[model samples]
Target chain A: MNKRKVYIFLGFSFAYLAGMFSSDIKSYFIKEVYSTEYGNLVFKCDQAMREHFIAKQVVAAKPNAEHASSLMQAEIALIDCQDYDLARKKLLSFGLNEYDLIELSLRAIEEKSEDIRKVVEIHEIRYD
Target chain B: MKFDTIKPFLCALAVWFVFAYTYEAAYAGLRDNTLIDAGKHFIYSTSLTPIDPNIKKASLGSKLFEDVRLSFNGKMSCALCHIDKFGSSDGLRNSIGIGGEGEGSERLDSDGLVVPRNSLPLWGRGESDFQTFFWDGKVEKEGGKVRSQFGDYAPSNDPLTVAIHLPFVEIREMVNDDYEVKSSLKTESVKSAEKIYDRLLERVKENQEYVSAFDELYFLKLDEIEFIHIADAIKVFIQSKFRLQKTRFEKYVKQESVLSPDEVAGGLIFFGKGKCVSCHSGRHFTDFKYHSIPFVQAGFGKNGFGVDYGRFNVTHDPDDLYKFRTPPLTNVEKTAPYGHSGSALTMEEAVIYHFDPLRLISTENMTPLERSEFYKKLLASSEDSELIPYLDDDEVDTLILFLKTLSYEESSE
Candidate 1:
């Protein structure tokens, strides 16, 4: 081939190679960072923070016996640290796996936690 | 004139004719009377009964609506879930009841009982021809006979009055679901509800303000005050406060106001191609019928395990599975997070869910069980959803604009 023809052919080959391995080439240059440590810490912190907050709110609000019992049940479900056998049975009955149970429990806890915070706020307002 | 000489002028005239015809055809819904005529067939003026509520009774009812003393827990009231800021809704996905504290999102922070259903707004409720109540139509009137959980011993023949009787006796609403309440009250029986009413009446009678007001309004002595009287007073207050006010759409229909081009286009889509008029027909913008739209179920459902049977819970019919009453659209703009589960956060999403529910679903995030539940809902969806013609993004936006026209004037409210 002539010099111009050789250059043109080389350009096309280079373009084809780039197109073929673009994603892999990009991945080599740009690495995705994922910190399992940070994720695990966040998860643990959230669980602990919620539990402590719920405990403090319950004490401060001085909710009635019935409300206290109900709160206890919700807090138990929310924390998900204990009562594995109960959780497993409930999940089985609902035809759900552990992940689904965790999701549902967290959602229920979020709602309950919201309510607990409101009660504490009300108590503060009334006393203050 | 030579053929070449006349050709340019003839061509120009032809172009002008085509342009005019295209423009007219594109805007025919606005320029002509056909769209308005078609809209008239579906919509009518809100037929509100003129109510002159007795000052004393309505005042008492207003007080009672806010009074926590009516609840067994002394923490909940009708005002807690039905606030003015949310246009009579609590601004939560599911209403926090009995053990809940504060108002709106503030209630979410408390350990309050989650009601598992979105709070229905009070606008245009108990108005003329508005017969159904609740998302499941649990309290309804058919063939002039009021039907409710009360069965044969319905407290009042009036549907709204019977509906008013519910929250006061409902578990997790006003009454605590403790062993004492459950054992003493039998919770589900008519006798138990009657007993609870008597207890509430006694509490109301203890307050001198309520007693005097009841005496003035009903000519009943403090001892003679019944639970029915309380319901009637609250009904009067609701009727007076939340009655349907005239909307921009009403004014447009009455020839008092002119809608913008976008609004007109939206109105055309809503009544014509959107097929929204099928379920959202009549004066109050509801046929008061049940429909299943297959919206994403959020939180633990009414039947538990993230599955709500909706109207099937009431009728126990297989056809009624996943069906819910068509909610009245009055003040709909203010009541955000729509649907029976309050899953759709905006008006656009709610409207989109009606025809394109799967478009909003994230299949990657869903578990096997959730996917199975969604499949069941998809199967149970109404055939009416199929009737809606495909709308482009602009058409959907315009349709939302038309919905805004249905909003009552801020000053009027």
Candidate 2:
């Protein structure tokens, strides 16, 4: 095999691999940032709506009116996720009405409320 | 020199050349085909998104607007009330819902009932500035950003406070409820209203046509069938199709509208001395803010008496009393009798109210107040006439011509 040919084959392989991995890589980065934002908002909202952010399993075990409110706050914090529709369902099965769902989501976006970076990280870990 | 060496080299070269040519040709076709496929996929995928270029959503929006099921009764579509011919009011003083028929005047508080207020025109209400709906600025509220003020108006009877109107509010007690039907008083009894709402969703879901449309564009989760989405979709439809008709005034400003000199002069009076510009600002001709002008409740009173507390009823604030939103003058020529109560029958009649509003300011007023405060400063002493300007009859005719230019009919297509 010629030296130039070896380089050409290598280049083509590299290009193909890059193209295949690009969207996933970009999505990962976006998810990370979004997760950071989501985390911060969840904390603020849990505090604002006076609910605590907890894992889905934990929430499911204690699905009561208070837990529902907490779930709503977390769901709002996670709304910017790519799988927000799914996240919303999981939250609602734990039980949240339409108005509560939307209101909480909007509240999470309020500026200067609290640190959302950690909540966003949690969101990334859960959804990403 | 050797026969073996020469023949072998030639054979090897020929094979190599052939393989290269075949590979190159195959790659060329693959590259072209891949490019085409990618472009097609991009176009198709984008069509499913909200900002799609092909505008499939807009087409769907048009179809939904034509769907009659949106009304409480299957008979009343948005088009029935806000028709093009009738100035968007069904040509009646008040609109009839599920209940019996009545003029706008008759819909006022009678038998301990009222239709709330006259139906607002849909044209240009989709403008971002016009978020709040109804007479009281109740639909989309404006609570300040302060944490304490958040949902400040939450407890109010505004439609936004609760996602759905109470069963009684939705049904039109158009006439005095002589039958004494308890179910009629509540929205819960409106004969399968929820089923109707569900059917609307089912129409979108079950219909093979809509399913394909949704699949092509984007799939909506069944659980997302809240009233807001329904309202948003309808809002989109109205925003997309029923755009306000552009007028000669637009062209005149751009030097494109053909206007006679007299009419042009009259146009200046409208914005300048006539003081129509203060409230009727922006492209669609309204600031979408509330104001109280001294105008009479021509028909019956919704809030009782001539004092129609506009935004006040919604806000329960003293400032908002009699302060209705300034109606956009988009199709003003057609959408009369003007005022919240539809009191003024003609533009001439309406304009005259602006000239001296004290007379019609309130039912108890000794003087007719100017219906439009925008013109009070413009009412020069030189204008001797109580109603229109003291300008020569020719200018008045010109003003009328200019006003005529504001007229626009919706596109038939």
Candidate 3:
């Protein structure tokens, strides 16, 4: 095909693809806020239930040596929203202490953050 | 001097011949030596690991396990088919669940719906290695997520917990298949399953004993409780109660135990020439994968026309047709009749049926329809199948003996 014809075909393909996935793309850009209330959470009921179950499991887990409750609550927060920022805030609100540095490292590791490799060393350097 | 030297040389030559002949005969007598090497090979192939479950929660879960209220009809429980006496299976060629009375053989007389496949034993299912569940592997942990009939909305992250949702909601198994019953449960969506779970939770909570017990056990506020909680608890319970104990095979692997000559030979045949390890590999005695072996159809299958297209029922892919999950064989001797149909009466029969299914199927007994249906099953299973190597009678006996070494007596109490 000539460049003019190729451009026309590509334009149509782009339009079709965008039209097909407009809602999915919209959903991804928006920060997901799941609710336990049935009406609000209807479509994502399964996700809400799974989050709640994870919360229960966190609560049931054996306590670590120090700052365990805060760590546990952090884990629950993460399960609820899976938003690291939100979970970190929740953890801080629960009162981060000696476990904060390590707990943060755990979350960073779980999320596979680019800064994860030196997390433990950084924590020790900061705290020690 | 010459005569003396010749005599000595002849005597030495005669002694060496006799010694060589005796050594060959001794080697013939100790044919079981190969079996020891086979045992070593078997040990190299499989490893056994034990699990730790929350004792308090598992105890509470045990109560829920036997509670008949788990079913919508109040007719069935997990215990109905997974009887302790029958190697944690129903001891039927095919399970007859719901609308059934009595246990084992007497269940046949009931007006219950016959679930097409044989009741699978729960042995080694609680193990982490046993990542998939059910005959078709509808609920499986794959690609770092639980996949199931629930699709994107699988009830839980844990596949076993997700698998727990199936039995109670299944129409023919736990819920009555009647139109009224179906309508009562609402439509067959993930929402429909949630609605049933909600109702079942209410029913469970209504029992004061369960309410107090669960409240104390899970340390939960009453409203926080849900059906997946029940599933999780039962999952823990199964894990705790059925964790791999030191089987004779495990002990033999560790060099802390010994196998009889027959058992060693059988173990050899299983791991080596038998080719069973091709499908039934690893610690759980399963690769936790699916393959077709042309098992005979029993009762009405999941699909009408006396035909069930196994994994195809789940995936609808032509390649997956006639495939069933290779079942773990931890306690094979007791969990008979074997095969997906429970068609093989004895372990020997089950082993033999792998190679020669026609030997087990009584042509005289099968109706024209059954025979035709079975032939269709054969055709579907013929291509790209798990290879079932031929076993002689002694080898079959030895295999059964080896299987017995995998079992240990259990106390539900």
Q: What is the lDDT, from 0 to 100, of the residue A74 in candidate 1?
A: 31
Candidate 3 reaches a DockQ of 0.01
Query: Is model 3 an incorrect, acceptable, medium or high docking prediction?
Result: incorrect
RMSD of each predicted structure: 21.9, 27.4, 28.9
Residue-level error in angstroms, candidate 3, position A8 = 99
Candidate 3 lDDT over residue span B1-413, tens digit each: 68887998999999989987896556433434444444444334555465778898898789888988888788789889889788889889889988887789989998988887888877667777677999899889988899898989987888888887798888778888888766666577888888778888999888887777778878777788888889988998888876766677777766677777667657655654465665665566776777777667766777876677888988999888888888887777778878777767788777776777887778779889888877776776566342445555666787788889878745422
Candidate 3 residue A68 Cα shift, in angstroms, is 49
Off by over 4 Å in 2: A1-128, B1-55, B100-116, B140-218, B221-224, B304-307, B357-398, B409-413
For candidate 3 chain B, the 10 contiguous residues with the lowest summed lDDT are B28-37
Q: Which candidate number maximizes TM-score?
A: 1
Q: For residues B92-182, what per-residue lDDT tens digits would candidate 2 score against the true structure?
A: 4545544433334442333323444556666655444444556555555445321111233222333322322222135442222335434
Model 3 C-alpha lDDT per residue in residues A5-38, reported as the tens digit of each score: 9999999999999999985564333222211121
